[model samples]
Target: MIHEHEWQQWQQQSANHAATAAFLLLDVQTNLTMLETLQAALDKIRANPAAEPYSLSGNSYFIQLQPHRVLIEELYGDDYAEPVTLSLDDFGDALAYWHTQI
Candidate 1:
């Protein structure tokens, strides 16, 4: 469940990049659990490199999980845009940074 403190932390988090902005704007109910879900997807890919990629909608963005990496695409209502690639390790680092900031 989402906590007020967490939401407050998010409010103080940076949105300096497009990908970060997308993550920040995700719908709290269905998409705020992205870190866990993305980590799980990273594990799945690591377990089987041949595993098919999967795409999950984060209400306002789409995360496409591939082997060792993810593609983040911001969405506007029904429209989708180009995806930005991010290694799972890099995403972990980003999370770590956010944690430190909070």
Candidate 2:
């Protein structure tokens, strides 16, 4: 589970980056607990090599990394009402940096 401090830091990073949404990409290799999966996901994101982006229903994006997946949603609402396609490179860079801060 994410500690209070970690959550606070994550919120700060999200605010700094102006991120609309964030999701954890759990590792599927091991039968890990929720806390462990969360931690592993965070670690992998920090060292993420590359990510593949897939469009999902309802203006959502799924970022896949092997056995893990990060879903970024609400990309085309309110703050971002216009249709905008964020580059994979940009997303990866932002995600990596955001994970590092957390």
Best by TM-score: 1
In candidate 2, the residue pairs with backbone N, CA or C atoms under 3 Å apart (3 or more residues apart, or in different chains) clash, namely none
Off by over 4 Å in 2: 1-80
Candidate 1 Cα deviation (angstroms), residue 53: 1.1
Q: Supply candidate 2's per-residue lDDT for 32.
A: 38
lDDT digits (tens) for residues 1-102 of candidate 1: 234456455434433244753574453233435556655776788789799997777667777778778777776655555667776665555454444434
Best by lDDT: 1
Candidate 1 regions with alpha-carbon error over 4 angstroms:
1-21, 24-34, 77-81, 95-102
Worst 10 residues of 1 by lDDT: 9-18
TM-scores of all predicted structures: 0.57, 0.29
Clashes of each: 0, 0
Worst 10 residues of 2 by lDDT: 20-29
